[model samples]
Target: MVDDVADVAELGVLTASAAEWSVAVRRAEVIGRLAQEPRVRIAEADEAATQLGISRRQVYELLKRWRAGSQVASDLLPRRSTGGRGRGRLPEEVEALLLEVIRSRYLTRQRRTVSAVYEEVVRQCRTRGLAVPSRGTLERRIGRLDPVASVTARQGADAARALRSAGGEPPVVEGLLEQVQIDHTVVDLEIVDERYRRPIGRPYVTVAIDVASHCVVGLVVILEPPSALSVGLCLAHMATDKRPWLERLGVEAAWPMSGKPREIFTDNAPEFTSEALQRGCDQDGIKQSYRPPGQPHFGGIIERLIGTMMEMVHELPGTTFSNPAERGGYDSQASAVLTLAELNKWLALAVAVYHGQVHGTLKQTPAGRWEQGVAEGGRPATVSSETAFLVDFLPAERRTLTRTGFTLDHVQYYCDALKPWIARRRQLEKIVLRRDPRDISRVWALDPDGDSYLPVPYRTMSRPPISLWEQRAAVARLRELGRDQVNETALFAMVEQMRQITEDAAARTRRARREVERRSATPVTRRTPQDPAPLPPAAAQDPAEGEPVRPFEVIEQW
Candidate 1:
């Protein structure tokens, strides 16, 4: 018997596993028996239980109770029957309104919390004069409604479609030195010059990063756009600072040694496309590449660095301009000087901290990553300092020579180093002159035929201004000589012009003084009268006659 019972129990468990309501038969039977009715035939109980798939024994018990008059007919109906009408758990109209509100307000924001949604539900219920549901109840209803979920699913689908249209490929950067990304960001601090203690201008930060190692190879903060001049300066600094690493790696100083870069990524700013920048890159054998319009993420590494710089700058003390004139204000020069000194000190400290600290992405300091890459067989793809200086230091210009061996702008230049080249070029009549933008005191003449450049020194002098007494003396001398060399009428006209200029200058000075006086005298606000004063005419009148009279003159007798 025990063995048979075990077998039956196992069979029952197996039968109930895949069937929906076999396990709930006992609970259903209890509910049905409690809800059974009398007088209406007991057959109704068995029929209802059979339709619900409950056991016949449970149905018979319910019918027995109904026959005993212990239950009601209404109780024998289906659990959810509305007497004869069908109704939803929540009204269809209310459900639709809830869905609309959730879709419009909560789903669009993408930040709908359960509490926030509950508050909104309560507000809606109050407006409609309905009882506010409990938070749990509202939450359960929302789960059943699931409108927000549908909206989110739609949004995700749209995003996936966009990704598919964009080719849906993960960004894969190529080999080391294959691509270099450069960009400029404004540093967040107000920087002032050390010498003047005045706001110099907003500092522009330019960064060059190796796409493979994610290392900052070059960084510069200049007070202007990333011009070719700025680029050259940064390159020169890198050559000096990064030389030991490059030497250790046995790499040549000239950049793009193996081949030109696959791409040189930068923004579509004017400086990136300037003639000077183009020529410089051409000389260095680098090909330029630009990011797609409005796509900063394409060059996100540098953009993140810019954010870091801004955070650091913001943490520092607020900067003040010492030179009021720099920002068009009135302030102490001493304060401006102090501010400038502090700015430089803080900037240096910040840069040092940044260079020493380890970067999260590179897992090493920027300088360290750069060195490691160099030591690990990566070549320093940069031009030699001497060669770079020779190519970029000279500024070329198109000019014609004058009879006096001078160029336009009255610049007379000659360099002893170029004597041999100039001697050979003298036969060519004219040559292109390249001057140094930094120092206009010297210029270089290029001999295309000889494949040589000649340096020339420039001599500049200013003629002195003629004095008034000197002009008069010259006129008298001309008259004594009985010569029409100096025209007296013209000389007087010149004197008259000078007089007019002096008069205009004096008038300007007086006007400026008057303006200062007016500003000083104008009251900021009217003062209340403390004591009244007699009118001028009233004070001057005699007391006896109450009329104005002139004062009598008296002479002192000794």
Candidate 2:
């Protein structure tokens, strides 16, 4: 039983302190059984309550949480500060004050000591009648700040530049697809929405580079922040033929570099180190390698490649530039024209151009080097189906098959594919499932008899597809309205309302911004009024729009 408990805790399903994990495991054992029951009887509830040493009412509440949380062990994990390493204990106003003070004082050229900063923070907090954060809390917060940014702000730009070096020697790799390095950053440009052509926000770009040939193995641009989903998408982009993606972009270009890498080198980010990523790599016989915690140069290849890509983006409209000094007196959003799709297309072309350019270190075009590497290593293996390959890398869940179907977060999934599994449900304990958070309308369940996965769609097919975030938001909204029991209909209705509100808000925001820009414009002189009123300055168009630019950077290296 002890060994079993340890094994359960190691499954990565629940991350918490030891005591918290033990409680979670015990609760999962009880609640997981209750959730799977065709019908929970009073006797069963009494027994579970006694086992967990909790009230019968609390047992029912736990059962509800377990069922609604996709039957994961984490659903039962303690939520308070004592239970897990989560929950921001500080008040919102206090937290805001801490951040403001830290940014305005600590991260400056003055280079105040942590002790001095803490003293100042305490004085200000007291003056504002707010709870002061402990010294350790402030220190930890400072540690979590962007390292390069912190260094640059305190030490100097040159000192920060030194930290980016991979040390004295570069890592050595053997052949094609031997080592792939990936990293992501917010693109230095604002992109517009397709519907309104108004600047929505900057998107993140994740890039992967093959170490041996220095060829970009994969790239994905998304409006969302870096997460397991984005990482999986980027990896999928890297490990498949780029020609299909390029074709979809309708751009004529050659991007033949494609295949699964022997190993991946990434930064020590939570998303990069997720259990899903590790399991996926294990299943595909791929190795996982993290950049050394103190070494910045180990990830230099991908960083430099990303740097080049951002430079290319700098040439596009609405570029915020590398820093505020570079963007002096410029209004990025005012000139923004490209939509997300258009920016993606533009990036596709930029990548095509970059691939043909000769690398300073390799002394050969990335594409040419890739061809040579293929000649030497005889082409790396790649997956035929991107979705099938990606399913393993997606977030994992476990659910018991019911007669009707598998219900998760109040949504039931069913299909003919699950009919056989449903019949033999008693034979199996719980089957593992994988879900793409972007779309929760369907999930892939692992087959008990075989290694194949079966796609399970929503039992109510007419239910509009919604993201995991949308579902959670809808649930929260329902809870706020004192509607504890949320049905599929109610949840989706709330989602629709939320989406409509967002659309209306975005329209209003765009109109307001345009009006502000018009009002804030510099007045033309009277002399210009006499000279044909300067023809209204031709509307200050973005050159990237209304025309396609040839790749002046592309090198002829056939």
Candidate 3:
């Protein structure tokens, strides 16, 4: 027979539950209407009992209760049987004592099993002159307590609250560029070096995701690890239109997402706390917020997007699969086929795919969400200009303007525009020089009088473009080679010398490993060299107390 209680529940009736008694009363009503008489016949009652899966006596009893005229079906149904053997025999005091221990000692403290609580109760009963209930009886009592209440008492508020369906307020982002999340993750693929085309390990990819639309506004894949410079470049990327960038990558899609975000959400990474980033945001009127410490899930949107992007990366060669188990002995470095530049281009195309693909949470493509946000009066925040944004975001250093121009980390930069300030005793003011950490060939100098920046390039036009990383590496190489006084000419020369040798050595090593070399094993020798003739006993003796200690001192005073 179908359970009316469960059926009513499945129908989603929000009122009181349909108990077994109410279900029986419903069957009785059907029986009464079928009988169409003052009193129900035994065969009629038996038929109803068969249909309802009840006894004839129960059918007649339900009919009698129904005729008594109760408005509710449950009231007309038979009451449940009770008072079986040993039931309700627990003394009131014993019951009270057990409940108190369970509530105060077990539930309210560290979680304890019912058996443990029962044993404690039994022990307490032995201390006093009271009898203890059986373990089965105690288990029934424990089961009757509200599960949620018990969990709250035994565990913690956070744990108990997590069990519920509801939670804290959802993020309130309503438009594109309203709230943006930025994070850095190392791309799970080995990329070759730009020059040598040899695997140079993985690169870090910094991404900025729009919170409302789930669109990637900006991304930067850098050879260097995550740092303040990477963060600055990422923000610069976010503020610029991506059409030219896409074209550079040879992609045909239209990526119209760009602009200064009104607010950027980031974690408490040291790069996010950098002065240049903070100043740029302040100058551009962008609000910056850091996630609270230890709670990484607050930035789950960007993390998930990074994971999705990596899924594309995993499809390529040289991919370090998500985990060691998934990789299954794949050699990412050995199989590397994409150079950093190629990876950059591939990422640009892959991101376009992401923008067009449907998002599970938003139920639409990110581009579609962006369009909807635009239709609802959401627009991109404006910046002065792309070039200006880059200048603002670049790391700054203080240098004195002299006849030779500014010298940053021993690299000389000169421009004809600085001639007026050259060799002139100006007021005590230091010029602010901003340089891209990736490329140090040129720097932007703030012109105090005009309040604009002037580009200063290396005086020697023949010098190759040197990055900050390369410059530092060259300095370290020179130091290792016993050259302390470094000049720009010597620095570049050393960097070129080291680069060729390092690349050649790596290539040779790779080739050598591939060629199998076989050699015959030689017989081993166990004999140890005899101990050197014990140093002469007379010569080894210590100098006499208060006597000059060495032969040189004893020989003569210079």
Best by lDDT: 2
lDDT of 1 by residue, 1-558 (tens): 333232222222221222323434543455445454434345665666667677667666655544553243322332333675422245444554455555555555375777887788878888987666677755554454333234445464444333332423436764655677777766545544432334443456676666765555555555444565455444443333344434433444422122123456888887677665675466555678877776556667667766676666655443223233543543322232223234434544455466667888768875565556557755554322322233332345656454434452333544344444445554655566654332343444555555344444443222122332334544665566675655434554554554455445433443333222222222121121222111111011222353334321110000
lDDT for 199 (candidate 3): 72
lDDT of 3 by residue, 1-558 (tens): 123332222221222234544565676567657545776777887888888888988777766755664434543444434557434466666766666677667776578877778889999888878887889877776665555556767886556665543424556788788899999998999866544556767778999999989999989886667887778778767876677667766777767777778899999988898877887678667899987676666788898889888898999999998888999989998899887668878888788888998999899999999989877765564332344466666788999877788889878988666776674637638898888765577777777665456667777656766567668978998888898898888899986775566555665553221111100001111211121111110011122234321221111110
Error of 1 at 192 (Å): 3.4
Q: Model 2 over residues 349-408: C-alpha lDDT tens digits?
A: 888888888889889998888889877768776655566667778898889889987888
Candidate 3 segments exceeding 4 Å error? 1-167, 193-198, 378-385, 419-426, 449-451, 459-461, 509-558
How many times do residue backbones clash in model 3? 0
How well does candidate 2 match the true structure in TM-score terms?
0.62
Residue-level lDDT for 319 in candidate 1: 25
Query: CA RMSD for every model?
Result: 31.4, 25.3, 24.8
When 1 and 2 are scored with lDDT, the better candidate is 2
lDDT agreement of model 1 with the native? 0.47
Model 1: weakest 10-residue lDDT segment is 531-540
The collision pairs in model 2 are: 165-297, 166-297
TM-score computed on alpha carbons, candidate 3: 0.63
Please provide the root mean square deviation of candidate 1 (C-alpha atoms, Å): 31.4
- Which pairs of residues collide in candidate 1? 253-382, 254-382, 255-381, 255-382, 322-336, 413-457, 414-456, 414-457, 415-456
